[model samples]
Target: MKNVLIVDDERSFLSSVSEGLSAYAAEFNTLTAENGKKAIEILNSTQVDLVVTDLKMPEMDGFELLAYMSRQFPDIPVIVMTAYGTPEIKERVQSMRVSQYLEKPLDFKELVDKIFLELAASSEGYIRGITLPTFLQLVEMERKTCTLKITSKGRIGYLYFNEGQLIGAETETDKGEKAAYEIVCWEDAEIEIESICRRKHRNISTTLGHIIMEGFRLKDEKERAVEKENIIEVGIEETGEVDGEEEIILETLEKEEKMNTLKDILNEFTKLQSVTAVCLVGRDGFLLDSIARTGIDTEMVGAIASSGFGAAESMGRQLGKGELTMSMLEFENGPVMFSPVGENAFLVIVAEKDANLGMIRLKLKKHSHELAAVAAI
Candidate 1:
């Protein structure tokens, strides 16, 4: 069963909508809030799948509620209702990414249909097949307020968020930023979202971006240590002898070869005209590797590129077009390109707006297979 939160200031209208939706009681339960403040209280305690809100209210209006939801409950879809609907108002509502907007005197059947559609499209209360870094970037981007219970390798940890900022984190034996770093670096972590944040006081002062970068560094170090240990153990087991010096040399050569292969491929894009950044990103939005001349957030770039490319591919399918070969988004400063590298990852190129796009496309096509080969490795 699903819960639908309806927020409206007018008592009579609210009652009418609730009564009308009661017919679908078996399908979903309706929760009513007179204003946004009350609505938030319900959200903190209940698992709401959809929100239907009126734009005007005394304490907190629909827009305020929508802003709050965008930060805290972005996965939940919303339907905006307003009596004073205009073109301008519709445009503003669209920008907020509302699932549907119905002017005053809405059709009851239409409203119910929209609700059902939105609910059906939701994530079934589980966020899966997404990387932790990508999910964290989403929380930061949306300014969400929630607590995430993360389980990885049979160990559990908690990350608290208040309005999109990572306020606190903890494991059974650790707390604060140190715990956060460890949790972020965990492999194959599963996340469960809680709408309420229990931590009122901030415990971590480090920025999320810096924390993520540091976490990746720590993860790399830990992986290297494990690899070295495994190599030593294998030698001792197979030959009944351990040569620390030889193992160290072999590890160094292996690491160098792997790094050089990907590095050489990424470096080629840096030599191109007006290129600012080049990256290989996993389909799940993880940044595999990157080369950048500018101070761009490569992680953020990779996350956005993966999401945008997915949307483009979806759009193509809907339009009866073929597979997405390449897609680009042109902004005032530059253009960002996305193309599939292999089944598991893609390539991203960020360049100045006036850069020779034709040449860049040619280079991208020429090198895509090579990058795919490296990714396969």
Candidate 2:
């Protein structure tokens, strides 16, 4: 028999759903929680096959609960219930990849059908008790040649390996290295291994270690972006009162002033000879802002720059250096420089090979204080 947990704040709705589902007691058991907190307690103590939850509750809302489940019990399927049912809400839930979504005033028979379907699907072809990263590492250690089929949240991807080296990966929308990055970052995936290697040529040139690290960085960046959007939405909702209008206007103006100051500092850097791009990046590897002469993925550059700078800082510490003020990486085409801007962020400068390094360094030192002042705001 399976156990299905239903979480909502309404006692009357819980009572009705539990009683209505009692007819199928022989097939499965129904569990109820008043809010996400209670649902978490029940989940910690009991074996739950599925979760059906509403989006809003007093303590520990549905979004928080879903995040907890994704980290702890990713293999278990979920069915989301929401009264708002707005496109924005649906899109957010879809991004989380829930098994099913049903609006409030749910049809009893339909809910039951979805529960059974999810339960049955969860039971099939799931390679439980192992993590994707661990399995990949083991395959590499064993020097195995094969292909892996991975499924998570209704998406499927394939990874091809030859003698333990990842050669290629494929998904519906991505291929090669990009696809591999996406697949490696997936959580709670069901994996199937086949003893065959179909792709003879290598499409992914980077080591598996690099791919995994980049995958995690990409995942963290995406999560942070989503969190920032949520915070902005909450801020807007909270400031909707007429009494807060003047305060809101003042705050907006202050923000604009700080932004203009930062942009001015960036513009100074852009005016330097042979300078291709200038970016302000958070210490956590997120791009705060940028100015560039050409099209470039500044976010990716920010993340990589942070990682590289971190390594350089570690090296300096080991070498008994007092502190790391600046670091630079030079390639055949250009040089990239990284320097601390403020306590919370850093500055990056990309310049052509023929650029005057002495003048660039001098300008960087001159404007670093100004940039730091604006960044601190």
Best by lDDT: 2
After superposition, candidate 2 runs with Cα above 4 Å error: 1-128, 241-377
Worst 10 residues of 1 by lDDT: 89-98
Against the reference, the lDDT scores of all candidates come to 0.75, 0.76
For 173-288, candidate 2 gives per-residue lDDT tens digits of 99999999999888777676666888888889997766765786567557646755665566666777545574675577557656876896798678654689999988888888
lDDT of 1 by residue, 1-377 (tens): 89999998888888999999999999999999999899999999999888888766778766456556645665667776755346643443332222455667888988998788668767554321234654565455446677888887799999889988999999999999889989887766666766678799888999776677677556655776687678656656766545665666567656665667578668867765467999999988989899997679999988888889899989999999988899888999989889998888899999885454654665566567657876776
Error of 1 at 320 (Å): 50
Q: Quick one: best TM-score, which candidate?
A: 1
Candidate 1 residue spans exceeding 4 A from truth: 1-128, 235-377
All candidates: CA RMSD in angstroms? 14.1, 21.7
Q: Going through the candidates in order, what is the number of backbone clashes in each?
A: 1, 0
| Model 1 local distance difference test score | 0.75
